[model samples]
Target: MTYRAAIVGTGGIAASHIAALRGRSDVTAAAAIDVADDRVHEFARNWEIPRTFTSLTDALASEDIDVIHLCTPPATHLPLAREALAGGVHVLLEKPPALSLAEHHELISAVDSSTATASVIFQHRFGSGATALRQLASTGKLGKPTVTTCDTQWYRDDAYYAVPWHGTWAAEGGGPTMGHGIHQFDLMLSVLGRWEQVSSMTARRTRPVETEDISAAVVRFASGALATVVNSVVSPRQESRLRFDFEFATIELVHLYGYDDSAWTFTPAPGHEELAETWGDLLTGRPSGHAAQFDDYYRALAAGRVPEVSARNALHTLEFAAAIYASAAQNRAVSCTELTSSSAVWRSMNPGRTARAAASA
Candidate 1:
């Protein structure tokens, strides 16, 4: 039986969802929905989607869509996901799942009360290399992780932020730290496990936007591993890289967007030369992208289980992003536990600025 999906928000990222659905015989893109009528119609025509709607409400009422792929902006994720969950339809959200941890927790509650499940798009975790890395790390084949680095240094000019929502805290959330680097660092967290603390700094040096164009953070994982993370849209040299230095070996991946096994290098420590052969045997050549993740999601649905990158799993990544913002805004290290609903940063990423403004008034 084929599952039907609706691609909501016919934007740049919606095409990736459409392509993933098209590649799978067990799933099909049945409809397209967007606030703009012309954009929705054009997207449907371009992708040969069967139906189109100007709103999710009309689409949900009119079509038997099994899942809604929300490629909308950060601000719309919570409400759109709630709407989809209300209809008992599964939801696949683009990353930075919700604007804040509070919003994410609310969505989690919505999922708990609904018959359907909600998942965020962190496709990198489904990559074969990432899978191998996680397994090796979990089983201690890589030995204890000591140090790591995750960097997303890509160039996004002023024109990129010219989009009304691109650099705004209200819409896009928090620039590259939340929007762009999330995919890479989410992959990092997937391999490294729970992060305990974060110390960060954000700056808006180049881009003329409300949000910071570049951000840096030092993260401490539960395993006592320390990681330096850098998310930047102002760098001239574009690269997405992650390096894990374990006791036995130093494994690294360097690629701008997506990577296959070739992009990863497993360098064994002096006495552990044989581990390189193990790495070669374990690495699956499958590349990381939407198609791989969609396949896994469908399989989970078939088995009547929650999918990878489920709301609960995504909450950790979102919390990490929030912690970066909170740490930067508050000018101190932020613990994951401090991000409860009562926290000021729970509602806004730059709560310190708001507090300072209020105090001056």
Candidate 2:
């Protein structure tokens, strides 16, 4: 079945979603929606969308949209996702899916009750290098993986945060840990099965943002592999990198934002060079990006199954982020299950209680 897709928000991110959807034969960019009438119409014209709606209410009511690409902010995801699912429409959610675990669980419920499905845009996991690592580890070619790392260091000037929602916990969520590094770290969780605990620290530094501009954490995975995670928007030389140290070989991937085969290196142990050759031969040329993942998501959707980066799968990544905030705020280590609804730290990852402080003022 060909999917009739609609783009729900026409912003900077909408470009990525549109560009990827434009050339797909199995999907049609059926409609475009945005609050700005003039801007949305122009966006639709440029993208060659045959239909446009200024209001989501009107768009959902008028268009028989099979899937909705939610390129809006984190704060809008819960309602947009829920509404789409309730309408039996699948959703292609942008990263951080929700601000908290509670919201994520709700989306899962909506998904369970309907034929529709929802998946986050953790496109980095779709890359050939990452796919290779996951497969190699699963096949025992990488030996028992012991150490993994995710580091995202990029600069975001004050001008970058001038957007009204840029820095707020209620809107943009929690600074770099939530907004910037989640794409890379989500890819980390994709390779490593599960995380057991985390210890983290966060600071606002110089960005003048409500949430932290830098966050550092150490994560212990269920597989006995320990990972170091660092998120920052203050660095000058930007880079996104991940490394895996297995009993037999050390695999490394380094790039900014997205990576291709050119960014990955497979280093072999003296006796395990054969294994390296085997790994290098797989997933070599595929690049990590939105289009690669969308192909997987749409194929699974057409098959009537939960797609890659499904809500249930992405919850673990969200839990890890929440655990980081909880750990950083309390200055202690936190277990994965500690961020349940009953936990005070589950209260939306906003540091310093600035909102609460101002609400009482």
Candidate 3:
């Protein structure tokens, strides 16, 4: 049976998914849903979507959708996703699955209790570059990763924050770390498995937003490797870069937004130089993005298995970000184990007035 999907929240991101799903034989663009009438209808007319509704309730009520693509703001992800699963519809949420780990757990509960499945848009993980790295790591070709560096430095102007939800912790969750750097760092975590602890510092350097525009962290992975993570929106020249220092060679990827094989470079250490040929053969031509992940998502739905980028997988990245914020706020190193249901930061990501402050008062 061909699967049907409804595009929710007709924003800039929704256009990417619509374009990706245009000619897929396994999934159909069943309808479009958004609270904004003009934007939703315009999206529908442009994409030639057969149906459109201004509310999820109305679209679900009509029984015209099997999947929901949530491109709405971060604050609304949990409720809308839970509602969709409750109605027996699958959900594909955009990045930053939830505002906090606590909210993410609730969505996990929703998926657990319902027959429907849900996934997050950690699209970078689905790329050829990611696949090649995973193989190298597993095969011991990359050896033990000694250090990893992830830097997401891009400029967002004052006008970018004009959107009511763009900069607020309550809406966007956090700053560059939670919003922009997430994709790059999520890929970092994908390459290096679990994180042991994180020491971080966040500051609102220049952007007149509620959240920090500049932040840095030192993360220790479970594999005894160290990683330095930097997220910033103050850079004049932007780049998304990640580097892994393994025993035999150092692998680095440099690109903005997306990358293919050409964006990656490998340098071998002394006496172990033949790995360059092996690495070149492993890289793929297709750059990673929404389209790459959509291919995997549709394939999973076609089979009986749950999709890639599952809620649990997405939680690792979310928990990692939470650790950074919690560590920065509490002025100490934070372990993954500390971010539990009872944790203060789990309830909110705001640094100025944390959940701890509210609970203590």
Instruction: Please report how far candidate 1 places residue 218 from its true position, in Å.
Output: 1.0
C-alpha positional error of residue 262 in candidate 1 after TM-score superposition, expressed in Å:
0.8
- Model 2 steric clash pairs: none
User: How do the residues 239-324 of candidate 2 rate in per-residue lDDT, one tens digit apiece?
Assistant: 98889899999989899978899899889888988986788789668898989999899889878778978999999888889899
Weakest ten-residue segment in model 3 by summed lDDT = 350-359
Please list the residue runs of candidate 2 whose C-alpha ends up more than 4 Å from where it truly belongs after superposition: 351-361
Candidate 3 lDDT over residue span 1-361, tens digit each:
7888999999999999999887888888989999999999999999999898998988999966789999999999999999999988999999899998889999999999889899999888877878888888889877889999999999999999999999898888999989999998999999999999999999998888999898899999999999999999999999999999999999899999888878888899988788888877887777898989998998888786899798987999998888888888889999989888777677887645664476699
In candidate 1, what residue range of length 10 has the lowest lDDT sum?
349-358
- Candidate 1: TM-score? 0.97
- lDDT string, candidate 1, 1-361, tens digits: 7899999998999988888787688888989999999999999999999899999999999999999999999899999999999989999999889987888999999999999999999999888999989888888888999999999999999888788999998898788999999999999999998999999999999998999999999999999999999999999999999999999999999999899988998999999998888878888788999998998999999889999889998999999999999888878999989988777778777786557756899
Error of 3 at 113 (Å): 0.7
Model 3 Cα shift for residue 333 (angstroms) = 0.9
Candidate 3 residue 343 Cα shift, in angstroms, is: 1.8
C-alpha TM-score for every candidate = 0.97, 0.96, 0.97
Q: lDDT (CA) for every model shown? A: 0.91, 0.88, 0.89
